[model samples]
Target: MKKPLIDMKNIRKTYANGSLEVEVLKGISLTIDQGEFVSIIGSSGSGKSTLMNIIGCLDTCSLGEYLLDSKDINSYTEKELAIVRNEKIGFIFQKFNLLAKLNCYENVELPLIYRCMETQERRERVLKSLEMVGLSDRLKHRPSEMSGGQQQRVAIARALACAPPLILADEPTGNLDSKSSNEIMNILIDLNRKGVTLVLITHDNDIAELAHRIIRISDGEITSSIDCKRGM
Candidate 1:
């Protein structure tokens, strides 16, 4: 049997509210297979973002067993988790998260630099990922020089440069117009077609339906996990 890329069992997250305690996740359990495209959908205050944070190793669940790539995530130290985040997960944020000072090429190459990749190899990856996003022509342009769509493309290129096993996209089209949203979705669909594992977090049902599987979350719990590939 092929082991799942992500496995979570009875995951929970709680936050302290001064004298009170609040639970954000209520014993959530899920799995994502390699090369699968899954969308997690929910409205605001649904704890969807918190779930994404745990999945990306950005935050730890208060209680649960999470095996990422067959390793126990809860057992890993913070530094080890940082390494895992860098090598195994690519993140696309709604805000783009590009540095104000860096140009396109520099921004895309940042992760590779953290990995201490050789100069020539870093050059190849930056160019290839930028080309994938149609941003190779804007290598020298800074974030201020581009529109929201273009900046999002640059962010996508940054995520791709690492060639990570999983991509975590959080409302990637939230900042874009209709045409730009479609274009970004097309790019993501193409990436999935080429065997990239993707987990998209969105509140829009229309966008969620685009994935191979749809998991609807509500009030810190998953209401449904549907295989929606047939609808495509």
Candidate 2:
């Protein structure tokens, strides 16, 4: 049998603000299969973002186990976690995190450059990723020259350039117009159909409906997990 893509058991996260200890995640557990499309929905401060950070290898749990691609997350050092992040996960943030000065192609090619990919291969990957996002024609345009939607597309292309197995999108449509939001969601749906496991983090119910499974969280705990794909 194929192994699960993500496994978290009894996960907990806490923050220390001076003498106060704040428990953010309270024994959360979840499993995501390869090729699955799952959404984590929560209001602000529901620990949804905290969960996303752990799953993306950007943060470690204070307690419990997290196995990503069958490797123990606790075993990876900070440097190893950085490598794991680049190799296994693609992240899309609410804010289009593209640098203002870099052109679309340059932004998309950044990860490849960090990986030390050859010039020719980097060019091909960047072109292909931009094409996937329908921004091939905007390759030379800087982020400042593009609309919010266009800038977000560039961000998506940057995420795709590395071809990571899991795509973690945190409110990818938060800053877009309705038309642009739909376009972005459609692109994400297409990516899911093409076999990239997706985990979307959103507070919008309509947006969460797009996923096959919707896991709702409140007060740092899972309130509900609905499988929407059951009849489909």
Candidate 3:
């Protein structure tokens, strides 16, 4: 059997301020397999953001083992972590985070360009990713010209263009309307169906329930984890 895509053990995070050390995460351990859609739901001040930062390689835990794609990420240097973030993981934010001056195609192609991918392959990835999000026709349109749902789709396309093994989405639908939220969620579900490993950070239970597994966090610890078994 293939090893799980994410394997974390006894994870802990703490922040130090002068003489005070505040523990933000307390002994969190979880494993997510490849192709799994998992949601981590927590309210404000729950330490979920800190956990997300650690999972995304933007921060490290004070104590614990975190293996992503079977590699021990906690052992990597800052530069190595940056490379992992750029080449192995794709990130989607609540804000679309697209350049206002760049059109849809250009926005999606930006990461590939940074990777110095050959032009032909870069074009193929951008076009294929846009097609996946049903935005192939909006290639030349700017984010200002699209609806909220469309802009989020473009964001998803940008993440997909990297062909990374993991996708980290933080409140991806937070800025959209109900219709647009549903649209974005459905697109995410479809992507998971096609074998993308996605970890969604959200506070909305209704939105969290859409994922196959729901992990609830509170007071810097995991309160509960439910396997919906709703069929992946």
Candidate 1 residue runs with Cα over 4 Å from true position: 230-232
Q: TM-score of predicted model 2?
A: 0.97
The C-alpha stretches of model 2 lying farther than 4 A from their native spots are none
C-alpha TM-scores of all predictions? 0.97, 0.97, 0.95
Worst 10 residues of 3 by lDDT: 223-232
lDDT of 2 at 1: 67
Query: Can you write out model 3's per-residue Cα lDDT over 1-232, one digit (the tens) per residue?
Result: 6459999999999899899999999999989999899999988999898988999999999999999998999889999998898888889999889999999999999989888899999999999999998999999999999988899899999999988888999999999899999989999998888889999999888889888899999999999999875544
C-alpha RMSD for every candidate = 1.2, 1.1, 1.4
Q: Give the best candidate by lDDT.
A: 1
The residue-by-residue lDDT of candidate 2 on 94-144, one tens digit each, is 998999889999999999999999999999999999999999899899998
Mark the regions of model 3 whose C-alpha exceeds 4 Å error after superposition: none
* Global local distance difference test of model 1: 0.94
Check candidate 1 and list the clashing pairs.
Answer: none
Cα displacement (angstroms), candidate 3, residue 79, comes to 1.9
